[model samples]
Target chain A: MSTIALPHQERGASFWRLVELVGCYVLGLLWIMPLLYAVWMAIHPPEYEVRFDLFAPLTLDNFIAAWSAAPFARYFFNTFVLISVILVAQFVICTLAAYAFARYEFKGKTVIFMLILLQLMVMPEVLLVENYRTMVRLGLVDTVLAMGLPYMASAFGIFLLRQAFLTVPKELDDAARVEGAGSVGVLLRVYVPLARPVYVAYGLVSVSYHWNNLLWPLVITNSVSTRPLTVGLQVFASPDQGVQWSIISAAALMTSAPLLIAFLLFQRQFVQSFMRAGIK
Target chain B: MSKLSRLQSQATPWLLLLPAAVLLATFTHIPAVTTFINSFYTTPRGARPARFVGVEQYQSMLADPVFLAALKNNAIYALGTVPLAIGLSLLMAIIVNSSIRGRALLRMSFFLPTVLPMIAVANIWLFFYTPGYGLFDQILANFGFSSTNWLGSPNTALPSLMLLGIWKEAGFFMIFYLAALQQISPSLAEAAALEGASRWYYFRRIVFPLLMPTTLFVLVNALINSFRLIDHVIVMTRGGPDNASTLLLYYIYNTAFRFWDTAYASALTMVLLAALAAFSFIQFGILDRKVHYK
Candidate 1:
């Protein structure tokens, strides 16, 4: 097989390979064009936003202007508190439920698991109207808690942790039991340590998701005190603001920078874990 | 061994599951049922208490032009995005998976959009599509073409949004394809090469069929995404100059919040829920068959 391909590779394959390479490079440039544009527009003065010049003077005026145009500090603080609460709650709730599903057998177990899985397809966002009413009824409307409650019991987290827990060797459970360690102790010491990678992967996904999520937050929180960055950016970028491209781009980059920087720094782990997390 | 211990074990699972089960019931299941029930009631107005009006909201939704347009637009948006995005991502995966120079940079560029928020991407694209002096128009003018209203025009608005959808999602789908591609043994490619099969022929006969499971998984996700990924629509067009890009979920949002028509929004949500349920059924059926095959 190697011999046959060697001759062909010397014949027409190089040309085609070259074409494929060039094609990929072009596509790559096209893919990253928006980000490049954002950087260019964001750093340059408003006049040079649409103009491309290698010698154009760059400034931080856009960022300074965008910062003052909205209460971004409050928005960032709201988003920070929102994602932290949600991630913590998800960890606790999903760990317990996943441990049960992975290790225990009880009546109606299958039925309960199926019910939990149903949320995978029928996400809370689908029933936003009713969820809003539920929030209002609880007097949680316009609060950051309202933004995070629906996502506290995450189906994806439970499923991922359950898979992770199932992979822990039964011998470890028995050894822990022989040492007179309770089930909770076994889970905390053994299973949790074993599932650290899964936890990191799930945590990254959850943080990025809630950070970028806009629609539900927009619908749930109307006050500046509770609005996340995405909603804040949306309000900032409204067309009625007369298309301040430079300032808008600055705000956009500012809001997305944390995730983008983390992704760039942890590219391999981010991609690998996303794959390992079996999002597909 | 003892009856008491057996009883304790029996209660353990349920006790552990209590918090999750309660939260899920409170948020997901209960809200879903309420959404269904609320769809059958009229929106309560000042000095006018809510009353049951079975199927009236649904009837109005049927008669409502905006709802109909949104439904049609969403269907078109899904049809446009799902296949194109899948195909583009597959191509991207194949390209990156092969022995190409600068593959790391290429893969990073492809995956970059997935990291950025839709609102940010929409803002950048808004500048690109801006009339007269936008990046696109500036480039087009270099070729003596007139500037066009990419997002403002009805004919191009939905497609413009679709383009953003594809750009934002194809890289995400590419990661999945890349994972699948890496799993395929290289020996098959050697065998295909021994048979003197061309690259296209090998991909068509060997690579694609081997990727069916991944394709199915990606297809379900893409379908769900078509409904969920209206963030760009909100940021870019806000469903457009004439609701040309109004998707079902976005329409539900407007109906409920902007108009304060909760009952009508619930009715719209019921339709969205029904669509999701159908997709889930299809997914589970396919997944079950795949499991059986395994």
Candidate 2:
């Protein structure tokens, strides 16, 4: 197999490979053009936004302007609280539910699991009208809690953790039980530690999702005190804000900086975890 | 084991599941039911309690021009975004999966858009679509072409949105494809090359069939995304240029919040829910086929 097509085929393949590589590179450039363009507009002064100058003066005034223009400090704090609460709640809730589903022989388990998976298809955002009504009824509207409430019991997290747990050796569970560990202790010790990679994967997915999620957050939060960065950026960048491209670009970048920086810093883990999450 | 211990075991699982079950019921199951129920009623106004109308909204939806336009636009939107996203993502996966130079940078570039919020992306693209002052016009003017209003014109509004959809989504689907590609054994490719099969031919025949399951998974996600993704529409177009870009979810949003027509929004949501249900059914069918393959 190696020698039969070694000489001529190798040359031809390498030629085509070169073409393909160049094609991929061009597409890659086009793919990130928006981000590049945004960064260019953001770091430079407004006069140089459309100007193509190699030695253009750069400034951080746009960031300062964008920050002071909105209550971004409050918005960042709101988003921080929102995602942290949701992540902790999801980890706890999904861990318990997944432990039950993975280890137990309970009645109607399959039925309940199916019901939970329905959320994957019809997310709370899809039922925004009713969910908002529910939030209002519960008197939690316009709060950070409202933004994260629907996502507290995440089906994806439960499913992913359940799959991870099911792969754990039975001997490990029996050993943990033999040590007189309660269900919660066994879960915390055996299942959670064993599923550390899955946790990281789910965590990355969840944080990024809630961070980037706009529609439900946009609909639910009415006050600046509770609005997350996505909603704040939306309000800041809306048509009535009078189209300061550099300022809008700065605001957009500022809101997305944490996740973007984390992604770059942990590029391999981010890609691998996203790949891991997608596999199932 | 004693009877008490057996009983404890029985209660334990339920106890473990209690919190999740309650939260899920509160946010998901109950609201879903309420959305369905509200679809059959009229919106309550000041000094007016809600009245049961029994599918009147659905009947009216059939005659509503905006609803029809949104429905038609969403269909076209789905048709446009899904196949293109799938294809481009597959191409991207194949490129990155190979022993290509600068794979990390390329992969990062491909996936960068997925991390940014859709609203932010729309804000940036909104600038790009600005007439005579935007990226597209600036580039086209280099070729002596006159500036055109991309989003402000009806004919181009939906397509412009579709282009953004494809760009935003292709990288996401690429991750799944890349995962699938990594799982493919290398021996088959060696055998194909030994048999003198061209790269394109090998991809079309051998690789594509092997990727059918991933394709189906990405397809379902893409279909669902077409209905659910209205963030860009909200930020960029707002269903502008005479409702040319009004997606179903966006319309439902406007009906519910802007107009305070909760009942009508519920009815619209029911339609979206029904469509999602249909997509899930397709997913089940695909899952069954995948099982059969295994």
Candidate 3:
């Protein structure tokens, strides 16, 4: 920290600073170029896809074509249902488990907690073969339930909620208990309300994750009615469809629009939520 | 407390933990054990119900060329992507955290890729990598280089995917770095400035050490993600050009679903589980010593 900055170093620093700023912007532009290009190609006619012209007429025919080409509405509905089921279940299940871990001392608590945390490593994604077998035995193949079941008890969610619940002061719990609130009542009145921000953070992360998740859903769902947007997009853009770049780009954008729009609208919260989820 | 209350207290935590326990057991724990157990058996075609093959399946997996290739490809993928993504994310975090113009917009651009589905990002990059008229070709044409088959050729296939991996992941990691950066006191920078210390000198000696925990955290995630990368492969290449881009998990998917070789896929999954277990070891073993838990 005490290295001497010579007289000429000050002048060089400002020059390098400008270069660094410009470099940052340039990299940012490079980072977003693919998405920008997708938007450009999607909005314009097919002929203008490879040829970029500022004066090109923009139309939504690609979107219209994409919409009519597939059962995207049904796919959207399945995705919505899938994510909702997963999110709600995760919230309920993880909250209960997290609460137990945060507030209670019990037998085999450490071992059980460690076993639960193992999910973070050997995720369902890696155990697809056996999980698929499990689904087959359960008679849950091709259903939205199969897609959401494997992910319901999210170790990540439990961990995050536990961290949040631990930060809640014990006095609040005792006060609620003295006021004649039962354990569940205390949890609902004190811990849940106070952990609202963590809930919001966890909810956003969970929704985004399941919404974007493809592999497991693709494996489990055999019908269009159960396929999420990601699987549907893969099927629509598959090589047998003959590489219609414009329509595919539009479909891609459409499939991602809800998340993209939400992210843009609440950029700060989204970023913070991701940050919160990632830390510890 | 009453006797009933004491009894309730003893039972409450287990009751609360029941749902998650059942679900986790059903999905994660049971499946993991079953995957390992099934790896030692045959695929059980028709009436021949899966007879125990012992280490026969393991030996065949050792002999399988594609499995070895996928293993090598995944190693290369993890090696290439993790360090690059971590470095680029740290750089992006630094740039965004500084007193720069349009920091919000810059931050948004970097983080926007993280929000989009990997499948969609692969779709966009698929177009970019298309030969003759793709985005890359158009730019390379300006410099008078002939258009090359990016994903079609075996030599460039995995590297091309790695490029996309870095692009999509850096921003996600950046948020973690940014969070860590904010926790750092500003007075450290101010004191360094007052001492006339060079910015690079301060960053190298002071800031880098402070960011070690975040780096380790991001490193573990990036490594895990590298193995989990099958979406883009499914989207773009499908491990094409003579299985050049075939990652371990992608191969596992292909084996289990496409080839209907569930037994071999279980063996492959065991390999992946082993890799993850190694990372878990690193997380608990090294992370405990290095990461300061404030």
> Any runs in candidate 1 off by more than 4 Å, and if so which?
A1-10, B286-294
TM-score of each prediction: 0.96, 0.97, 0.97
Distance from true position, residue A274, model 3, in Å? 1.0
DockQ of each: 0.58, 0.57, 0.60
TM-scores of chain B alone in all candidate structures, in the order given: 0.96, 0.96, 0.97
Write candidate 2's Cα lDDT for B1-294 as tens digits.
999998998999999899999999998899889889998999999999999999899999999999999999999999999999999999888878876678899999999999888888889899999999999999999999999999999999999999999999999999999988888777878888778887667777777887888888899989999999899999999998899999999999999999999999999998999999999999896564663323
Give residue A227's lDDT in candidate 1 (0 to 100). 96
**Native contact fraction, candidates in order:** 0.64, 0.63, 0.73
Tens-place lDDT per residue, model 3, A119-238, is 888778889998999999999999999999999999999999999999999999999999999989999999999999899999999999888999999999989989999999999999
Q: In model 1 chain B, which range of ten residues has the least summed lDDT?
A: B285-294
Instruction: Rank candidates, DockQ, best first.
Output: 3, 1, 2
Give the better candidate number (1 or 3) by lDDT.
3
Candidate 3 local lDDT, B77-129, one digit each (tens):
99999999999999899888876788899899999888999999899899999
Task: Indicate the residue-level lDDT of B280 in model 3.
Answer: 80
In order, the interface RMSDs are 3.0, 3.2, 3.3
RMSD of 2: 2.1
Error of 2 at B52 (Å): 1.6
